[model samples]
Every structure is written in structure tokens, then in C-alpha cells.
Target: MSVDVSKIVRSHEGKRGKLISLLQDIQSRYNYLPREALEVVAEQTGIPLVDIYGVATFYRSFSLTPRGSHLVSVCLGTACHVRGGREVAEELERQLQIKPGQTTTDNEFTLETVNCLGACALGPIVVLDGRYFSKVSPARVKQIIKSARAGKEEHTADGHVFPVKVSCPRCNHSLMDFSHQIDGHSSVRMTMAFGGKHGWLRLSSLYGSFNLESEYDIPLDTVVNLFCPHCHAELISANVCPLCGAPMVPMLVIGGGMVQICARRGCKEHRLDLNGVNV
Candidate 1:
């Protein structure tokens, strides 16, 4: 059946929140929101094309390009950071031989990262084909990548889900931990800033794929962090609360990386590594 791109915008009745919902529906139906579909959305909503593109590109979960049958999303959120989220992002880039926004040549996978998935307790989260993987590590990255490439449908009980690696070429860092904290009171910007974390880079041109590990680390600072882990008076300084020891998780993250992914439908929150965060 032909997908109705226009209906997505029409359903919103020119509402603001619907823009996100509209984009989500469009992506769900088409796997990726086609440029043509976006243009249609702009026309229907009476919104400028630049504005629509900005909206689409603003969120980390939205994908402008088509995705593979199997999609791979590695979380670089805070909890995952201390657990090696950077290594995970880099290794996926290496394994796919493509940057975060680009897809593999074989059309088998797409790699992207997000600042915080609210699974801090499950830091170093990896979402494959929309399925959640919590508490991932550099050592576990390879196997996840392998299994993802091989299309394995399951994981071992020892906290191994899909195989993705996390080895850093500089100083043998091999990131084993990650952290997703906003330190400040404003919404964290996770987009590419002129001199911030998500800006353009000469990653491939400067340090060829074969030598990426030997090259320098790209300076990237997130520009659009908007989620609040919890809505309590003492929301700050918590993967889990210091006072009540309750978990504050993500309801959803609008945008940060290359794609616009939400938490799974059933769980509402992505999977996290309880053991990893405790350690």
C-alpha cells in the first residue's frame, strides 16, 4: 500500500507537538522520512522548508536517509559514557566504515548515538533494530556488532546482547564506562555546534579508516539535551536518586544524533545495565 505522507501532517491540525509525532509516524511507515515526504509536510503545515528540515535534523533519533533492514543505535548517554559510550560510537563507525549520519554500503545497518537515554543505571545502552540493550561495554561491543551483522536474535545471560566493540586507538583507552549528566540547568544542546561536540569534521579525510585509531579524537559537545530524568524536586545528581534510591529514566529523547528513535513501545524506556552502573 502507498504511504500517505500528507496525512501525517494533516492529522496534526497545525499543532506544535504533532511535528514530532508526525515525523515519528512518517519514519515508522517509510523506515526513513523521504525528503519528498518532508516537503509535503512543510506544504501541508504551512511551515517553511528550512524550518521543517531544521525540525527533522534537530532530533537525534530522526533519520534523513533510508535505514537498513537491521538498524543499530549505540547509546553515548551519561551512564553509558562512564561505561565506554565513545568507544562504542567509534568502533561502530569503524566496523561500518561510515560516519554516524551515513549508512553502510551494503545497506545492512545504520549507526547513531544519543547523549542520554535515561537508562543511566543501564549506561552504555545499545538499541538494535529498535530493541533495547542495556549496560553495554567495550569488550561487549565486538560481539554485538558480530551478532548484529550476522542477524542473531538473542543474547547471552552474562549481560551480552548484540556484539559491538569499544577499543580506542589512542593510549589503549578501551572505554569501559560512560555518564549522561546535564550539570547545568538549561536543556542540553545535543546538536552540532560550531565549536561543539556535533559539528562537522574531516574524520575520514584527515585520518583514513585504516588509521582512525591513530588519529586525534574529534571534539564534540552535545547541543540539544532536553529530557529530564525525573520530575521531582531533587531531580539533579541522579541515575538513581541519592536520597530515595529510585530510578529516573527517559520517557523519550527527541533528538541528538543521526536518527530520531524513541524508547521501545512496550517498555517506554530503553534497556539499561543495572550491574554496570552499580560498579
Candidate 2:
């Protein structure tokens, strides 16, 4: 579909400096930046093509090429890494036959990696269409993908479903976990997996593949950081609140998991049990 690029550019009020915002708006509408649209923006805003391209490449959030309908983001942070994130990634690549930063042949799904999802307790998690799945295995990956293609709802007769939660200290918003807003129109969530080949956080049923494990070259005790996808706040790395700079305290939830809330009382920029918080 050929979009009216000039209109989108006008949304920025023809401000040449708003190229980044203009591009973000266009990407949200089309899922990828079209060269035609970019050219139109250049013509309307008098911004050079080189400068616009620079901004697009500078952000990992921007995709120059077309993206699939379904985005599959796998987490590769210290916790998920230690638990077996790499193997899960490999399994996804094998099943989808597409590596990280690639899309399936039919353009049904795109597989990519984020550094972390902060659901350490739910290591080895897999998110599909913003929903979370904990303790995923390669075999389970196959089932999930197949089920999606076949238009079957995910009925984990053998797996566990845990909330992957996150929060924003800046806005006091319970940041959507595994979710990152790329453009203004739509937001997406990333899935996380373990690395060490040993995890099944809160499994309920017996899906045959939950017990599967793979070997890895890296150690499981690596350190990492978790950032808020919304406001880009540092939720877990320094053990301090990203908004107020107060120390964070670990508090237990109603069921069983723990969360790190801002220690500052008045500036309680903290949220709880919201999927994908700093784990």
C-alpha cells in the first residue's frame, strides 16, 4: 500500500528536526519504513535523505525492511542467558528457519532478541503475540508455531503460564513486560528463555518437551541489566530506582514471586505482578 507520506510529514508540522518522530510515526503505520515515503518526507521537509537514514539506523527499534505480522522477541540477558536462552533461540531459528533479525518465508513471524525481559523467576519464557509462556523448550517452540499457523489456541496441556512483569519508575506506570513500543501506533512484547538447560518455573501440565535441555558453552552466573521498555528506565541493573534514584527493595508477591520496588515511599514509582518486571 502506497501511503501518503506527505501527510505524515505534515504531522510533524514540517519541522526538519522532527525527522525521527516522523519516521517513527510512519513505521508504526506500515511496520517498516518505505523508501517512497521517506523520499516524500525529504521532499516535503527539506531534510536530506542521508540524515533521515542515519536516524533510522541509529535506533535498533527502527526496521528498514518489511516486518512479519507476528513479532517473536526472545530475551538474552544474564538470567535467561544462564538458564538457556541461546538454545531456545537456536531452536526458534531451526523451526522458523530464520536467524535472529530475520522473518519466516511467509512473513508470518519475525524472530529477534532483546537483552533482557526481567522475568528472572520465569526464565526460559516465550511470548507469542504479547502473551507469556515460561520454561519453554525447542519442542514446545515447534508446537507453538504450528499451533499459530493452524489457527489453534495455545492450550498448554503440559506447560506453565507465569506473568512476566515490569514497571516504570519515571511515570509510576506498571510498565508492560516484554513489551516495547516501536512506533506510536502499536507496541510489542519480547519473549524470554533460559540458558543453562535446567528450568521450569511454574509448570502446570505435562507437555512432553518441558524436560528437554541443551548444553551451552557459557556459564550461568553472568551479570546483566534490565531496562524499562516504556521510559527506558534502568529497573534492575544498579539496584536503584530508575526514576528517583532510591535504592530498590525486594518484596514478595501474594502468590510466590518477588519484585524490586522503589524504596522511596512518596515516590513509589513501583508496580507489582504486572508481567515482566525486573526479575
Candidate 3:
């Protein structure tokens, strides 16, 4: 499996502050950052190999070693721990036959334990390929693994789509527009600006659904800035999208958590943090 490190490097040739993005692209292509890829990146970009390694190690998302096709992360944070999180992890280990931080012999799955995924309210959470499973149990672990083995997409009993009501993180004003519904739920309304065009955008309030309507045609991969329609405060969060390294647009989940979606058009990376834990 030879990776075209040169082509990857050429894509970001003159772009400043693209090291993380460059590494992300490399990892996305190979499933993990190969040592040869890193070396080639350093040589092509004139960045020291040590610096590249530093960037790789600094972010837990970047992996220097080979990873399995599917990633399974079990939360062991205080909230999850109290809710039989350990038991869930043990069940995953039993089913997958791999300990934490180890990949299965078949390279199908890798198990990992993280301190927190910021969704403490949904304790005993298991994240498979960035999809959050709330209140995961030992029995559910088997189903999840089975689904992964069969390469079948897992959907909740009700089609895996659930509605959420969000407010502007800064102004606390409700962003839900009942007058305009999407996916049979109130749409999340926000003002957006991209490519010198400013207009209103409505997003499906469903956490897992990607249906959205924008005033302007947003080109795929284009990054947009989002603002609260009420207070007009920018909704951009400091956190970057784990999937595409794009700026995350955050909305306060009405009850107790925050939901963030990638600002880049067509990137289906969204996060739900019910307990507001940073990590």
C-alpha cells in the first residue's frame, strides 16, 4: 500500500497553518499516519521530522501506528465509570478479544478507553467511528460488534434520527424555528457568511441528520462562519472538527449539553456533549 505523500503535500503547498490539515488528510487516506508518510511530509514541507512527530503526538486524534478499520472508544470518565462504564469496556474486550489500546488480529477493530467524550449524562457511552451510543450496556456491545462485523450501518429503533432543540450558545436565545420544519422537527436557524455572501441558514435539528437549507449555495468543502440570529455573536468554537479539521459551529443543547457541527459544507461531523465536559 504505497501512499502518494507528494500529492498530499502538493495539495497544501502554499497554504499557511495547514500542518494539522495535512496530517489529517494523510491519516484519512491511510487510516493512520505511516512513518514513511511522516518522513515524506517533512521532506516535502521542510518541517523537521521532530516537529512533525510533536504535532502527531500532541493530538490524541493522530496516530503514528497502524489502526484497525473501525475504532471503538469506551468512555471511562467519572460519569461513565459510575454507570457501569467499566463493565461495558470489559464486554467489548470479551467480544472483540482485544484489550484497551490494542487492535484485533484481523485488523477489524481497535479498542480504546478515553477519559471523557463530553457526554457524561449519557454515561456508559461507547463511540464507534465517531457515532455516539448512549447508555451502552454489555448486551448492546455484542450487537454493536456484530453490526460492525457485518458492515451494516446501525440505526436506532426509530431510524437513528432524533430531534434536538438548540439555542445560541452565547445569547441563549432559542435557535429553533418552528415555522420552518425539517425532518419533521423545528429547524435550527442561524445567519451565515461565506464567500462574501451573508444569509440565513436552517439546519435540521435532528442530531444525526444532515438536511439543511441555506440562503446561498455553499460549495462543498467551503468553510462558513456562523452567527446567532439573536445576539449576532459568532458561534464558532475553539474546537476543530475531529473528522475534517474544520471549525466547529456550536449550539447549546437546551437541556444540559452542547452540540457542535463542522462549519465546512458537506462535512458530516457533529458532536453531542451532554455534560459539557471539555474532553
Candidate 4:
């Protein structure tokens, strides 16, 4: 459908950090983000199409395609997952006859499952529109669907927060729980980085290089250093490889945290703790 993206753009002139608001307005108008509108936004705001699309795709609230009148968000967070949230999702898929990230044929609802929604105590939760239903059972899927279609809100609960999941850049393995321990001294800052508010990663058999994205005058990787296998991007480092004497790649363990690993082809198993960057 044709949307007047120009109107949205005019209201959000000088579109710098207001990308979220711009996308939200567009979604509110069309019920989803249309490609044409995104292109128009890129043309008017001088932002790259990639950047616009990246922002739109990063957030859970934003939709790249058309949506139904109602949005059904299911929480599969850690706290929720341990409490039969997976079964709840499965029941929803079975009852609704639709998979996650799919809209119903009749355009009544859109099904999407998120990693976390906080509300740990309220495990196995299903959210219709914005209302939360806690302690959901597999048997209650039909009832919940019926209630939503009947225009009646079900039980709701406040949401809570949880830890982030870290992954390897090359293989996308989670590194949240580091099983192997090092006997070296650990600072408070280092502890905060491994389990903080940013992102999580799992680098069991892989190596991490320096991130190189620094606020201060961080130096560049020498010509002798290797690049990341996933992107071939120059690796960043604050520490050197103990075995190879090469620079180890730097990565965010989480917010206020950092990890360095040797990115050499045969040195993928090298994982080390480096100095933490102050947040």
C-alpha cells in the first residue's frame, strides 16, 4: 500500500537520533514498515538505507512487514523459559496455526516470540497487544486466543529484566557461562563486563580480537595481526597472544566488560581476559 512517508519525514526533520520515533510513527500509520517509506526516509534524511534498515530490524517493536490488528508477543526469556515457556510457545503455534514471526491468514494477530520480557515470577507468559498473561499453561492457549478475539483482556503482569546472551562472531555460539576458569586476579570491572547490561557471547572454540572502537586515541592493529574470520575486519587488541606473540582480538564481554582472544587460524582456542574499559 502507498504511504505518505513525506509527511512522516517532515514531522521528523533533522532525523539524527530520532530514527526510532520516525519508524514508530510510520509503523503506527501503516501498522508496519513498508520498504517504500524506508527508502523515502533515507532519501529525505540523508541516512544510508542500510543504517535505516538496521535500526528498524534491531528493535523488537518495529516490523518490516505488514502486521495484524493485534500483536502477540511471547516471552521465552530465561526465567520464563525454565517455567514451561517453550511449551506455551509450542501450544500457541499449534492453536494459532501460525509460527513465530508470522501473521494469521485473517489478519487478526501477529505472533512473535522474544528472548525476555522481565517478569520472571510470571513464567510461561503470553502477551496480547501489550497486556501480559502470567503462569500460562499449554491447555490455556485456546482460552487466551478466544479472549483476545472477544476483545477482552486477560491477566497481566509487570515485566522484569534478565542477563544478556553473548555469542561468537564467527559461529554465533553463546558465551554467557564461561565454564573454564583462569586463576589470575580478577578486578571488579572485569567481573561486571562478563555479565553486565550489554551483550553476551560464547567463544568456546573461537578467538576474539580487539574491538578497536574506542573513545580515546586507541592505536591500530599492526601489519602482523590477523583479521576476524567472519568479517575480515581488522582485529583490535589491548593484550598480546601468550603463545603466538600476536595481538589478541578485543570484544565486548558485556557492558563494562571486555574479552581478548587470538584470532589466528590454529589459535582459535585462545581466550584471555584483558583490561576493562570504563563505562
Maximum-TM-score candidate: 3
After superposing candidate 2 on the true structure, give the runs of residues whose Cα lies further than 4 Å from its correct spot.
Answer: 1-3, 14-17, 152-279
Q: What's model 3's overall lDDT?
A: 0.77
Tens-digit per-residue lDDT, 96-212, candidate 3: 998887889999988877777545777787877656788888888999888889988678422235466788755568999999999887899999999899999999987789999
Off by over 4 Å in 4: 1-3, 155-279
Report the candidate with higher TM-score, 3 versus 4. Answer: 3
- The TM-score that candidate 3 achieves is 0.65
lDDT of 4 at 164: 25
**How many Å off is the CA of 12 in candidate 1?**
3.5
Sort every candidate by TM-score, greatest first: 3, 2, 4, 1
Cα lDDT tens digits for candidate 4, 149-188:
9988755433222222233222323334444422211111
With candidate 1 superimposed using the best TM-score fit, by how many Å does residue 196's alpha carbon deviate from the native? Answer: 51
The whole-model C-alpha lDDT of candidate 1 against the native structure comes to: 0.47
Deviation of model 1 at 54, angstroms: 2.6
Q: Which 10 residues in a row give candidate 4 its minimum summed lDDT?
A: 185-194
**TM-score of candidate 1 versus the correct structure, residues matched by position:** 0.51
Question: After aligning candidate 4 to the native by TM-score, how far in Å is the CA of 277 from where it should be?
Answer: 28
Q: Deviation in angstroms for 159 in model 3? A: 9.0
